[model samples]
Structure formats: C-alpha cells, structure tokens
Target: MRPTDIETLVQVGRPTIAPDGAFAIFATSRPSIEANRSLSRLWRVDLPAGSPRPLTRGSGDRAPQLSPSGDVVGFLRPDTDGRTQLFVVEASGGEPVQVTDRALGVMSFAWAPDGGSLVFVSPVGERGRYGDVDGLGPDAESPRRITGIRWHANGAGYIVDRPTHLFVVDTPDLDAEPLVSPAPAVRPEGAPAPTARVVPNEARALTSGELSYGSPVFAADGHGLFALVSEIERDRADLRSRVVEVSLDAAGASERVVVDRDANLTVDDLIVTPAGDLALLASSVGDSGTDFVAACIGLHVRRDGAWIPLTDPETIDLGDPGSHVTALADGSFLAQSRTRGRVQLIRVTADGAIEVLRDDVEVTGHAATRDGATIVAAVADVTSFGELELVRFSGEGVGRRITALGRTPIAAIPSEREVAGRDGYPVHGWVAVPEGEGPFPVILQIHGGPYAHYGVHLFDETQVLVAAGYAVVYANPRGSAGYGRAHGRSIRHRMGTVDFADVIDFLDAAIEADSRLDGSRVGVMGGSYGGYLTAWTIAHDHRFAAAIVERGFLDPVSFAGTSDIGSFFGDEYVGVDPVEIEAQSPMAAVSLVRTPTLVVHSELDFRCPLEQATRYYTALKRQGVDAEMLVFPGENHELTRAGSPRHRVERFEAVL
Candidate 1:
C-alpha cells in the first residue's frame, strides 16, 4: 500500500444491485490527464465471487441502474454533441445502445415498471427544445437572457432558459448473453458479430409547461407517475413544491396531492411503496419570527387520496436531510443517516420505528434486492474508498465486503478524538498524521454546509494534506449535521462566533494532546461555510500562519444580493437586520488580519458568487496583508471536488 496522492484518488457514484442479487453495477470516475477532465465508466461485479470488470468503456458513463428483469443495465453518457444521453447495455458485456437522443440530454432516469421503457428528466427550453442553445440548435452561440431570480445555478450555469421536465423513452429488450466468459469480450470469432438494432428512441414529453418536475417515481401498479412539481411563484426563493400524480401516458395533466399539512413546506423526496402508498419527505418553512431551522423530516403516507403523517411529528431527523429513503416491502424503508459524526444505515419500520442497521461504516449508496431481504451497498471508511458489499437485515448490520475495487488512498487510518464543549456537548473529530514526522505543520481543514459534517468517511483533501507531510485535523462544530436539530441549527444567528469557538477549542485540545503537532505552524482552510469561518478565524484570531478560503462569503449583504439562494439565506441562516450582518462579516475587520491568505473562487459560482473572493482579496491587498487569488475559469463552487482532474491537482498543489 502507498500513500493516497491527490490526483489518483478514484471517485464512486451510485451503485445499484440486480433484482436477484446475483451481480451489481456501479460508476467509477478518474481524472483524465490527456483531457484535463474527469472520465467515468460503468463497472460490474459478480456477487459472492466479487469478480469485477468493466461493463461500459465510455468517456463518461454514470448512474448505473439494473432493470427489474435484471437483463440490462442503463446508464447516462454524453453524445457527440456533448449532451448527456441515456445508454443501455447487456448486463453481460456487449456494445451499449443509445436509448435517448434528446437535444439537451437526460439528467436522470428510472426504469419503467414493465422494463420496456425509461422515464427520464431533461432540461428543455420554453419552446420545447431540450436546451438547444435558446432553441437555436446545439451550435448556436447566443446571448443568455436572464429573466428570473433563480436564473443561474452555481455548478450548472444558466438554467432559466430550460426548465427540466419529464419524458419517457422506449427501450428494446436485450438478448441474454452467456454470463460465464473467458475474458471481457469472449464472443466466438467471425460468428456474425452482434450489432445493436438502430431503433428510434424518440422521447415523448410526459409533462409540459414552465414549471419543473423531478424525482419521478412510477406506481407499483405502473398506472400512476408521481413527482415533485414546483409551480412558478412570484417570490423566486419560495420553492413550494407538492407531490403530484399523473397518468404514465398523460402529457401535462397532473393532480396535486398535499403531502404537507401546510402548503408552505418543501417536498424534497417522493417514493411509491409496493402497497401504493406515497411516502415523501417534507420540510416546513418558517413564517413567523422564529429563526428558521431544519425541522424534523415529516414522513407522509398518502392513503385513499389523503396524505397522513406516518412517522411521529417529533421524529428525530435522520440527520442528513438530503439523503433519500429506499422503500422496502411491507412499507419499511432504509436511509443513509449521519450520527455522532459517522454515516449509518437507518431503517424506518412501517410503524415508524427507527433502527440503526449499520453504525460502523459510511454507506454512500445502496439498492434493495427484489426480495427486499438484502441490501447491496457501497460502503467506505476514512482509510478506503467505496466498494460493493452485501448487507443482510438478519445480521447485526456489519455486512460482508464484496469487491475491493481500487487501491485505497490512505496508508493509515485516522485517529478519533473528542473535545468537551459548552454544556457538556462533545465535539467529535479525526486526525491523520503523516509518517516519519516530528512536530509537523497542522492543516486544520473545515467542511462546508455548516449543516454538513466531516466524519469517519474517506475525504480526498484530508488524505492529500496528510500525504504531503502535513497533519490533518477536522471536527464537527456546533452547526454540523448528524447531531440533532438543535445542534445543527445552533449557528443560525451565530454562524461565525459559536462554530468558530467550537473549532478553536477542538484544535487547541488536539494540539495539547499531541506533542508532535506544530500548533504554531497551523494553517486553516475551508470551502463554503467552512470558508466563511476561515475568514472569520483570521479576522478574530491571528494564530493561523496561512489561510485558504474557497468559495466563501465575506460580506453578508453583498452575498444576499448576488447569491442564487440570497433571497432566503439571510432570513434562514443569518439575522435579517443589515447591521448585524455587517457586524458578522469578515470584511468588517480586515485591518485586524495579518496572515498570508489564498482566495480561491470559481467563475461560474453563483452560490457564493465570484464577488466574495474579489472583495476579500481586495481588502487583503488594501490592508497590505500577504494574499494571492486563484480564479478558476469554466468552473463553479464545486471546483475542488467535481471540477477537472488537472484543476483538482493544481488546487492541491497551490494550497501546498
């Protein structure tokens, strides 16, 4: 084993198991040196034997899902025009067939109930072309006319021209190939090489109009199609979504089913159980003077056309609100939840009993077997990346590891520790120390999402820092997820102050415990909320020797005006008053900072916007502080993680 370098770390996407649980398929991505980008390919692994092989050798294939019949696997890949389209190949190796050829390309898809067709979502312009360069064909270089508040997204640039809609494409049944072969492609030589039928996979628009529809789920009976539809609102920030049902063959007629008692709630996920019950996760929007917080995930079940609460109203939030639930037979569901700074598999029984199925490792992706007795999950820990594994419900949740996949980046496991905080709250964290080192420079890494946490999972940046002979330390502050709602929302009005103290306390405690850590040579770095705190730390305390702030906010008032989520973020995260926001801003105290800082920003980042970096850099220069700015072109806020491979390597190099 070798130390995991920054560039070679492979990324894993969704992993779906076959219906019979005989095999599983997943997407693997690696940075391409020639293209200066990332390329993904689909791979398959036989169960029990765990013999893994490449299923599709394409430039970028992702989102692998096995059909109900388990004969074919469907994935998304780009066409010649750079549009991502749906592709299907035999579960047994063969040439993949392009299933959909829409103009804009498919975003995501689900296998139809009969497995003869696929329901997919594609972004289309108002005039019905699939994002065809403002309906002027694929090669048109036209001016982007922005019309609304939510016109552009961070990573996905301009989105107002084309709102994503639902469409269904018919697929041809594949012939079964012999599963056992001597090699990857062992077809009989000169035996009439099999050719894919050139079928017309013209997609039909299932739903139409200006509003967007997503998370399309088919009824168990295959008659009704349910999805979350967002209606056009005067207030662009108000994403008041509801569960709507439409006939699978219908084209625009949809009936809303109130999943939330209050229509002001945002319906994130929708799933149709085997029993025809509509299970959805809804989050309430605070309207009164109370500080808006992430309330308990409201699990609703629609019975007899009326939605009713299935889980207790006060049910503990399964931690990660963005994680979807996989419904099992008899109405029970499995969800990936965060607890105590680690990812766990949580099972919500039909009667609403939440049980921790797997508590030791990070279960990133999972799929249920046809019998619903077993789950094939992609599990990873701090020292390793994702690998396919089988987890039986009858066991103690410590499933059997199946495929080793690729080499793990971490040569050694990170050590876990806890620091006592206010009111007996324990701040949990992990530290990865480099080998052959004494009093190493410490890189205090912070995670984003203020609501998202860093735990016992494989983080590439942390490994990269450790591999570079730096001691990496990260902890879950007061505002991170995995803890209950109170802890997650504790930094709502006090984002920089409370969370800053928690991190400082944890860092000091860690330094006190380890004699080989050079606390005086400490550098702080973070993205998004972590970036916000990084700037906050340099402003308040001058202990940090260097700082790297990636896509972070410096002025709350300017951020509230420029960010896509600016409309509601101030009301939700920070205090609404202008005076308080200015006081909390890092820009307000630039004269007090005396540390070398690196400001990284993306050109297309609409979340925090490029102004954040520019303003912060301007202040650093005006104050005559040591500062350098790196502006990534053709990238967004997710530049560090999902940007081009060459860029990711350069980012680490710059930070080092």
Candidate 2:
C-alpha cells in the first residue's frame, strides 16, 4: 500500500441515494499511477439486485446526484481547462449529456425537488475574486471584489465571491434562473454606492455576506430548503454552523435556525425524513478527551419547535468513528457503526430498540430504500475490492445478500492497539504492518489535530507506508479526540511537553512488544500540529533517524500571524503571546537538531505557510544540520491527501 500502490485502491466519495431507493449513485477515482492522474467516474448501484453499473467513462467525472424521479443522474465532468461543468444522463444507462457549458469550475450543485431543474454554485470570472461575477453590479464588477471571495492566501482561498449563492436552471429547456439574489445595502447620499445588474430571470442569492450556506436539501414536502450555514469570523476554528431553513418563495427572506450551535457540537449531513422531521449528524468535542466520545449516528426529531436527540450518546463514539444513519420510510433509522475495525449495520427503531440488520458485511455508505425491504450499503474487506451491497432484511431480523452492486478491493487493513505512555497513561494507536517482516523500518506517525484521533479504520497513507516495508504506528497521545474532553484539552499550554513524552513512551513500549519493529532506524512524520511535534522531537530527542515535517508549525509567533487559524491557536491551544512565542517555537530550538529532516509543504498552504518551513530550513542549514525543503506548487495545507496526484506521490517517496 505504498503511495505508488494507491492506484490500486479506488477512492469512493459523494454517495447519493436514488429516488426509488432501488440504487445509489457514487463517485470513485481510478488512479493511473503511470500517467500520474487519478481519473474519477460516476457509478450507480441497484439495491435489490446488488449490482452496480458505470454511468460515465473517461476521466474527471464526479459529484453524481440522482434525480428525484430516479430517471436521470447529474454529475460534473472536467473541461479542457481543468474546470468542471454539470452533465446529466439516464439512470438506466446511456451517454451523458453536457448540461452546463465548460467555463468556471462548478463547486457544488443540488437538484430541484420536481427533478425538472437544478441549482448550482460557481465562481463568477473577473468581477470578483476568482473572477466570480454572479451577483455584482456594473460598478462593483470593476472592483472585482465579492463578499465571500476575499483572497488572503490562506483565508482568501476559502472565501468565494458572493458567498456561493444558489442558481436554478430548468432541466428541460436548460434555461438558467436566479433563485436567490445578493442583498444591496443602502449607502449615504454622499458616499459611494456599489451597483450591479439585477438579473430578473437568472439565479439570485438566497443569502448574502460573510456567511455561507451549502449542502442544500429540499424538505420532503418541498416547502423549504434545509442547508448548513457556516458563519465565518476572524479568529476561531470553531465556526458557528447550524441547520437553517430557508423559504424557496422569497429570495431575501430570513432563515430560521433548525439547530443551535453548541460549544461541543458541529452539524453535518442534514436530511428531512419522510415523516416530516429533520435529522442531522452532530459531532461534539467535549471539555476533555474522555468527554470527547461521539455519538456515531444520531436521529434528531424535530419535535415541539426543537430538534431532539433520539440516539443515546453513551452507546456510540461518533467523533471520526465513521457512523452513518439513513432514514427508512417505516419511521425507523438504519444506523451503521464501525467499532474496533469492524463495521455493523443496525436498525434503530423509533423507540430506540436496536436490531442488527446485516452484521456480516463491513458497511461504509448505506441507504434505506423507500419500500424499506432492502438496505443498500457499500461493503469491502482488506483484500476484497469496494462494492455496493444490497441486503434484504426480513421482519425476523434475518438478512440475505441481494446483489454485489460494484466490486472494489479493500484498500487497507485497519487494526488497533493500546500502549502505555509517559506517566503510565493508556495511549491508543493504530498499526498497519507490511506483508513481510525482518525487522522492517518503523514509522512513528502522528495526527495533525493534536486533538484528532488515530481511529480504527482504513487509511491510504498508512497502507502505503506498510506496503513500503515500514511498520506504521499512529497513536492517540494525551491530547487526541474520542477519549474525552479532558484528554483532548490536556495538551493546551503543554505542547511539545506531555504529548511528546507520550509519543516517546508509545514508541518504546511498541518496540519492546513487537520484534518486527526496527526501532534504531525509525522515521517520524506529521503535518500541522504533528509537524510541529516532528520538528520538536528531532531537536529535543535524537531517537528518530529521519523526519518529515509537512506544513508544520516552526515558529509559534510567526505561525500565529500567518496561519488561517492562528488567532484561535494563540487564544486557545498555546496561550502564548509574541513574547513567549519564540520560547515555544521549534525554530528557536533548531540548533539542537541532529536527525536528517525533510521539510515538505505547499506554497499556497496558509495554514502553516511555507514560511514556517523556510524559517526552520534556513536555521537548520545555518546550523549545518542535514535538511532539505520541498514545495508543491498551487497546493494548500491539505496537499498530502488532496494535492496533485504526481506531487502527492513525490511527497510519499521523499518521506519514505
């Protein structure tokens, strides 16, 4: 499973249920390692038959959405300039018809309730940031600045012009119409006022300004649109987001919040049940690591003007646990939980009684059919390819395989382990061992969110390292999520101290427990916070033979100024001002580094920013420490997982 072998593992994403519940539409990537391109295709699975058929051919097909009538499927295809446009095809299978002309990139799209039209969001060219001219007037067009499309390198890339407003198009005639328009603010008589043409028949902005609304879902009755609104602010990773109900009739109408933002909870995947209740996936990080346990799947019933949690929090760990809940027509919910490297699909009754539906297969993505007789889920094993599986469950709780919708190999094997860290605390970790053994080199992998966990699930990079003859160990130190709020918050003001001690302790314990690990030639790698730790470890301890710091924090003070979330980190995680920044910075301590280090980052990564790496690389070179810097063009902090295929491959090769 080395980076080179990533081609064999098809990456699946954007799973959508078809109208009749007989099948599901999903997008998967076919990585051509030889050509250095990962081609994505659209696929559909028949639920009762458990068979899948390819809907699109060639490269760059993704974001497939099934029409409400199940008669057609819409998706995005790459154009000549690498921009993507909307296309549609018959659900039964046929040639795809390009619906939108290739111009600007299509960021996201949603089908109209009647299946006769669709609404999509894209950037307007030249009028604003990224050339997005969607809702701007003639006067505002020249300035080329849109409300949401501010370009500050890190923060700028995330901002889109005009806040990703919604636009609708009639499918039959391909006549584009504005559903929501940008709000115009009244200025003083002497002050300058922006002017933009109001396109009466074109798409209009539903909401305006700094806040963004997306993941739109039409209510079962088609009376309103349910979308997640992300309210952006200056200094916080915890942006205020909630489910908002917007009226489809009036473009400028105010939206009502269906779910309130709690300090611990973040909402995702909003859906309205057939019974007229709204359900959303809620994720929460508690006060400490122990309190940080998540409810993998929850059913929120809109009762008495508020959404009530139907699922008990104690029964599931939802934070990165990969639990999915699909609503059934019978009023029950299909809840799938991946526990300790195993996946189980359970049927949760409205009253909370849980019944096992199909416990034999590892269900990743699942959807309940309209008839409620069969459940379509994506299943796969470590060696088996990924495929859409249809399982018919009887009233007696028995399940029978209906069909093998699509076949895809399991990209990797996920396993869990517990090791003792410093102070005798239990630290959890995931280990992916290579096929062969002989004291193979080991990699001490650390997660980015010193607050995030190394869960029991499949990971592309872990498999890649394992396949490269490296035993990979990713641990949840004192500050990883899923343990509880206390555990997660414990790393605050103690970065590079307790967490680093935990890493050392875990490595010592792991090497002592396993003979396959060659501790003497170990490599350490991490990004963001993990990157900060990598640099700190090599400087403070000489145990690691080599290190790769990807978009990592080197100087805390500089990071606080440049990082997109820097203000949040300074106020929350480190709590260090300009005076103490250098004291806690790895670059300030770079003189002690002895291990050979590889500094890899993306030029566009405003999160860590290449400057952090440049500062360290220069210091290390000045101190005569062995180090090199590798920068990927036009990539951000997420380059390791989402960068160009060729660059991503090169990164892994350099690190391994």
**What are the RMSD figures for all models against the true structure?**
6.1, 7.7
What lDDT is reached at residue 109 by model 1?
88
Q: How much lDDT does each candidate structure score?
A: 0.75, 0.67
Q: How many Å off is the CA of 152 in candidate 2? A: 4.8
lDDT of 1: 0.75
**Model 2: how far residue 199 lies from native, Å:** 17
Poorly placed runs, candidate 2 (over 4 Å) = 1-3, 18-21, 101-103, 124-162, 173-211, 234-238, 250-265, 283-325, 334-364, 379-381, 391-415, 432-437, 455-460, 576-585
Please name the candidate that would achieve the greatest TM-score relative to the true structure: 1
Ten-residue stretch with the least lDDT total in model 1: 175-184
Instruction: Tell me the deviation in Å of residue 525 in model 2.
Output: 1.7
Residue 142, candidate 2: alpha-carbon lDDT:
49
lDDT (C-alpha) at residue 108 in model 2: 76
> Candidate 2's residue-wise lDDT over 24-54, tens digit each?
7887775676767777888766654455567
lDDT of 1 by residue, 1-656 (tens): 22215445566666887777677888878767578777889888887566779998897999988888888888999988888988889898798877777777788888877898888998886553345345567455556665555666676766766778988878755553422323345678776655443344567788877778888888888766788776434444665566677676454445656453245556668877777767777655555422336554556665666555565543355436336678877678887766776667777887778877677777777777645676777777765666666777433344777766556566447899998966566888888888875688998888898778787767787877777788888999988877777887888877787788888888888888998889989999999988888999998888888999889977788887788777777667778877777767787777788989999988889999999899889989998999999998888888877787677777777887
